[model samples]
Target: MEKTFLELISENQSILFKICNVYFREKVDKEDYHQELIIQLWKAFPDFKNTAKFSTWMYRVCINAAIDILRKDKKEIKKLVFQKSTYIIYLIMGLSPLEIRKDCLN
Candidate 1:
């Protein structure tokens, strides 16, 4: 099972890379995200009931990991500027306008 999982991961490595690219700005951040995704996948493997395709399961795992990382690293954008007049900050942070307004009020 371990060997099979290793082979599967090797074959689908690009999935990890793509997720990392979507979420991370620096190469090191991408690598960290990839590693986190792999760890999450391994931890969740035993309970994978296999109702869906492996790639589908993997994609969900990758996206969840990327989002988790994004949430954690959100404060890293403190120095970056978004036009204050528009909803650009909300858009960049992947929040809906309602969510952004709620956040801002807090």
Candidate 2:
């Protein structure tokens, strides 16, 4: 299971990179978010049912991890400026901020 998970994650690593790039600015914060994303993905791996594309699932997980970090740092969130591409992703994916926050925190 661990091997398979690692393989899947390796294939989808760009999802983590894109999310970290979108959600964080500073090098340290991006590094921290990358670690947090990997931990969350591992914790949630056992329940992955493969009903959806792994990349899509990974995108959700990455976003949720970012949101979790953002919620913890309200000041950082206020300072956040969503890039055009990030906004496009949100629009295209229909990832509502409220829904993400509720899903992430609970």
Identify the leading candidate in terms of TM-score: 2
Score residue 73 of candidate 1 by CA lDDT: 68
In candidate 1, which residue ranges exceed 4 Å CA deviation?
75-106
Locate the minimum summed-lDDT window of 10 residues in model 1: 77-86
Please give, for residues 5-44, the per-residue lDDT of candidate 2 as tens digits: 8899999988998999999999998998899999999998
Report the lDDT of model 2 for residue 92: 75
Query: Which has the greatest lDDT?
Result: 2
Per-structure clash totals for the candidates: 0, 0
Q: What is the TM-score of each candidate against the true structure?
A: 0.65, 0.68
What is the Cα-based TM-score of model 2?
A: 0.68
Error of 2 at 18 (Å): 0.4
Residue-by-residue lDDT tens digits, candidate 1, 2-30: 88788878888888888888778899878
Q: Which pairs clash inside model 1?
A: none
